[model samples]
Target chain A: MLWEMSASHIEESQDVTSQDLDEKLDLLSLQCLFLMNQVISMKVDIERRMKEGTGMLAKARYVMGGSSVSTLQIPSEEAGMTASTLSSFEESERMIGKSLRLKYYNFRVFPSAKVKDDTEDEVKDGIEQKLSNLQLDPRQSQASNPLRWFGVLVPNSLREAQKIFGGVLLLCAECSSIESELEAVIREIDILNQVKSNRQQK
Target chain B: MSDFPSSARPGKLLAIIGDEDTCVGFLLGGIGQLDKHRKSNFFVVDKSLYPSATNIEEIENAFQQFVKRDDVDIILINQHVAEVIRNVIDRHTSPIPAVLEIPSKDYPYDPSKDSILRRAKGMYTAEDFR
Candidate 1:
C-alpha cells in the first residue's frame, strides 16, 4: 500500500509539471502575438501618415495657389478651406509628425553612411546645370509640380477619369474592328458548310 | 504572399532615381524594367559622363516620368539626385506614390531638406496647453 501511494505521488507530480509547461507555452505564444500585432500596427500607421502628408500638402498648395488669388492677398475661406477645416487640419498635422518620427527613429543615423569627398560647389554647379537643362529651377517652385494649374483645369478625379476613358475607348474600338473581321470569316464558313451539305444531298 | 497576386498589391512597383551603384543594387533586387526605347524604371547619375548637363536633364525627366506613371508604388531618390531636382520633388502632391529621400555615395542625407519630415516638424510648434 505504501509503494502504491508513492507511485501515485510520482504520477501526480508529473501531471502538475506537464500542466505548468503547457501554461508557459500558452503565455509565450500570447506574447509573440502581441509583439507581432504591435509591429504590424506600426507599419500600417507609418504608411497612413505618409499618405496623409502627401494629400494635405497637395490640398494646401492648391488652396494657397488658387488662380483667383493672383496676388499675395489673403485667400477667401471659400476658395480653399474654412476656419473650422483649418483648425481640424492643425490637429491632424500633429499626428503626422509623431508617425514620421516613428519611421525615422530607427534609421535616424542612416546618412552617416555617406562619404564626403567632392567639393560642395562642384556638386551644386553640376546640379544647377542639370536643372536648367530639365527646365527645372530650385528658385521656381511651381515648375516641379506635376499637377500644377490642375485646380484651375478640372477636379482631379475628372482629369484622371478622362485619361482612363480615352484608354477604354481605344480598347473598345479595337475590339469592334476585330469583331467585324470575325463576322466576315464566319459568314464565309457558313456558305462553305451549305455547299458541302448540298453536294452530300445530291 | 500566398493569398493575393503580387500585381494587385498597391504600390507594387518601386521606382528608383539614384547613381549607377544605387540603381544596380536595386536592379539586382529585381526592380529594373527595360523597354525597347532603352528607357528604364531608373536613371543612373554619373558625374564622370562626358556631358554632365545631359545626364542631369535625363535624371530630371526620368524622375518626372516615374512620378507620373501609374504602375510605380514608391519612389526612392538619392539625396544628391533629389538635390538636383528638389523643386520638382517638393511640388509633387499625389499620395498614391510616396517619394522618399535616401543618401547617396557622395552626399549625406539632410533632414532639413526633407519635405515630409519638415512638415511633421511644423506641427510640433503649434500652440497647445494642457
Candidate 2:
C-alpha cells in the first residue's frame, strides 16, 4: 500500500511540473506578441505623421495657389485687398507652421527605436496624442493666398506651384510606404499560422 | 506702396538676379530678355566671385535697376541675393514692379528676412491665441 501511495504522489508532482511549464510558455508568448505589436504600431505612427505633414503642406500650397478651402480667389488686385492679404499671409504662415511643427514633433517624439520595453497600448496612446497635437483645425486653415498682391494671377504660375506641391506629397507618400514590407510579413505569418493549424487538425 | 499698378504700366517682363542654377532655371521658364541697352534682366552670380551674394553693392545695383525699370513689372530675385540688398529692399516702397524673393538652388526662402512679409507680420493687431 505504501508503494502505491508513493506512485500516485509522483504522478501528481509530474502533473504540477507540466502545468508550471505551460504557464511559463504562455508568459513568454505574451511577451513576444507584445513586442511585435509595439514595433508594428510604431511604424504605423511614423507613417501617419509623414502623411499628416504632407497633407498639411499640400493644402497650404493649394491655398497659396489662390483658392481657399471654402472660397475661390476674388478680385484681389484692388487696393482694398490689403486686408485680405494680411488674412492670407496669416494662413500661409500657419500652414508652413503646421508642417514644420509636425516634422519637428516627429523628430522629438520618435528620437530612436528603443521602444521595445514599452507595452503595445502605451506606444499606441503616445502616438495618438502626438498626431492629435499635429492636426490643424479646418476653420483656422481657410486663410486666403496673399500672392494676388503680386499679380501672380497666371494659370501657368499656379500650375507650376501645384506641381511642386504634388511632388512633395509624392515623396511623403513614398516615405509612408516603408512599413508595407514589415506589415506584409505580419500578414504572411498570420496566414501561415492558420494554414499550420488546419494541417495539424487534418 | 501704391494700391494698384498704374494703368500706363509696362508689364509682361520678369527680371532675374540669381545664382547660375536659379538664373538658368528662370531663363528656361521663358523670362530671358536682352534689350537695346545690352541689359539682360538675367544676372548670374558665380560663387567664385563671392559666396551667397556677398557682393552687396552688385546685388543692390541690380535690384535697384530692376525696380526702377518700366518694362519689367516683376523682379524675381534669389532670397540670398535679396539678403545682401536687404537695406535697399526695405527702403523700396513702390508697388509698381513687385519684388519677389525666391528660393535658390541651394538656399531656401526665409520669411524672416522678407521685407514685405515682415511688414505684413508687423501689421497684425490682434493677439494670436495659438
Candidate 3:
C-alpha cells in the first residue's frame, strides 16, 4: 500500500513540474511577440509618413508646372528661353531634395546586421547552424531581398512601396534576433522540466 | 505650442550673429519671439539690432546674456560673425548649449574651411607617430 502511495505522489510531482515549464515558455513567447508588434507598428508609421511626403512633392511639382502655363507672355524670344531655363533649374533642385530624403529613408530601413553585403549570407548561415546545434525548431527565414517581396505584394506603386516594405523587412530581422534569444532560454527550461519529470517517475 | 518641462526645455535665448539675409531666414524659422504679451522660441540677437561699429563689446554683452540663460539648447552664429567674436566664443566651455557656426545664405559651406575640423586635425597630427 505504501509503495503504491509513493508512486502516485511521484506521478503528481512530474505533472506539476511540466506544467510550470510550459507556463514559463508561454510567458517568454508572449514577451517576444509584444516586442515584434512594436517594431512592426513603427515601420508602418514610417511608411505612412514617406507616402505623405511623396504626395506633397507631387502636388508641388504640378502646381509649379501649371503656373508657368499662364505666365507665357514675353517681349523677346531670348527672355522666354532664359525664363524656361530658370524654371527647369528650380525643378531640378526640388527633385534633388526629394531624392536625398528618399535616400535617408532607405538608410534607416535596414537592420544593422544586413548593412554589409559581404557578410549577410554568412550571417544567415551562422544563425541556421546555431539553431540546429541547439536542436531548436527553426522559424521560416524571410527572403533576402526586400525589393522582390515589394514587387509581389505591392505591384502598382513599386518605388514608394519598396521603400515602405524595406522598413518592415528591417523590423522583421530585429524580431528574428529577439525570438532566437528567447528560444534558447525556453529550451533550457524545457530540458530542466524533462529531467524533473524523469526523476519523479522513478 | 507644446509646453516642455522647464528642465527638459531648450534654453530660452538664441543669438545669431550673421549677415542681414541669414538673420532674416532664422527669424522666419521662429528662433526668437519673446514679447511681454506673447510666448517666443528664442531671444534673437543679430548684427542689425546690435551693430558691430561698437566693436566686440556690444556683441560680447549679447553673447553673455544668451549663454547665461539656462534654457537654450543651441546657439547658431554665421562663420563671418564668429570670426569677429572668436575669443568670446572660444571662452565658452559650458556643454549645456552647443554653439554651431552656420553658413549664411549667400555663402557656400566649405568643409575644408571649418574651424572645428581644423582644430581636430591639428590635435590628430600632434599625436601622430613616425
Candidate 4:
C-alpha cells in the first residue's frame, strides 16, 4: 500500500513540474510576441523619419543650388578636423525572466567631445598634428560642429535633417537590442517545448 | 548558455553600409571614423554617384570587411542594399556584430523581409499556439 502511495506521489510531482514548464513557456512566447510588436513599430517609425529627413535634405540641396556643399564635405578625409566624437556601443544587461539575464549591445554617443578620451595620445604627424591643434582653438566654435564641414552657413533644413537622422540611429539601436532579446526568448521556449515533448514520450 | 559570440571585449564602432545621403547624414551625426590605416568605418554604397556600373560585388566586399573587422560591433545596412546581399547576411550567424536592416530614402521597411521578424514568425505560428 505504501509503495503504491509513493508511486502516485512521484507521478504527481512530475505533473507539477511539467505544469511549471508550460507556464514558463507561455510567458516566454508572450514576451516574444511583445518584442516582435515593438520592433515592427520602431522600424515603421524609422522608415517614416528617414523619408522626412531625405525630403528635407533634398530641399536643402535645391536651396543651395550649384554650390560646393557635397564636394567639399568629404567626411572620411576630414577625420583629423572632426570636432564631434564618433558613436559607439557598450554592453548592457537586463533581466527577462527569473535567472534569465540577457547581455546585449547598447549604442552610445559622445557628440562634440563632451566625453574626453584620456587614452587618445597626441598626434605627432605632420598635417594631422596641425589640424588637431586647429581644433583646439577656442575662437573656432563653429568648427565644434560636424555640420561646419558642409558649409559656414548651412540651411535650416539640413540641420533638421541631421537631427532626424541622429535620432533614428538610436531607434535603430533599440530595435537591434530588442530583436536580440526576442531571439533569446524564442530559444528558451524551444528548449522548454522539447522538454515537454520528451516527458510526454516517456 | 553563451548566446552572444565570443567577444571578451566590448565592440567600439557602429559601421554603416548606406547610400550617399544616408552616409552623409549619419557621418554628420558624428559616427564616422577612420582608423590609422585610413580605412573608414562607413562604406558609401552609392550607385548613382559612381555611374560606372558599381556592382553588388563592391557592396558585398564592404559588408564582408565590416563583418571581419573586430572593432565594428553593429552594421547598419539599408534594406535595399541588404537585399542584394541577403545570402551573405543570412549566413552571418554571430550575435556580437549584429546586422540591422534599415530603410533608405527610396525603400521603406517591410516587416516580412526582415530577417529577425521572419525567424520570430516561424516560432509562433497558428499551430504552435494550438
What lDDT does each candidate get?
A: 0.39, 0.40, 0.36, 0.67
Residue-pair clashes, model 4: 0
Which docking category, incorrect, acceptable, medium or high, applies to candidate 4?
acceptable
**lDDT of candidate 3 over A6-117, digit per residue (tens):** 3433344354555664565345345434534543444344344334433432343354443321112111222111100000000001111111100000011111122233
Report the C-alpha displacement of residue A17, candidate 2, in angstroms. 89
* lDDT: worst 10-residue window of model 3 chain A: A83-92
Model 4 is docked with a DockQ of: 0.32
Give the 10-residue window scoring lowest on summed lDDT in candidate 4 chain B. Answer: B1-10
Top-down lDDT ranking: 4, 2, 1, 3
Instruction: Give the poorly placed runs of model 4, Cα more than 4 Å off.
Output: A1-16, A66-72, A76-103, A110-144, B1-11, B48-54
- Candidate 1 per-residue lDDT, tens place, B91-112, comes to 8854435565655444554656
Candidate 3 residue B94 Cα shift, in angstroms, is 1.0
Could you report the Cα RMSD, in angstroms, for every candidate shown? 29.1, 26.4, 24.9, 11.5
Of the two candidates 1 and 2, the one with more favorable lDDT, higher being better, is: 2
TM for candidate 2 is: 0.36
Pitting candidate 2 against candidate 3, the one with the higher TM-score is 2
Best candidate (score: DockQ)? 4
TM-score of each: 0.36, 0.36, 0.33, 0.75
* Number of the predicted model whose TM-score against the real structure is largest: 4
In angstroms, the error of model 1 at A77 is 54
Model 1 — TM-score against the truth?
A: 0.36
Better of 2 and 3 by lDDT: 2
What does candidate 2's lDDT look like per residue over B1-130, in tens digits? 1322243222346566876544433332234555545576657666777644456667777788888777654566667777777788878754435555555435644547755445533432357213
Off by over 4 Å in 2: A1-202, B1-11, B51-54, B124-130
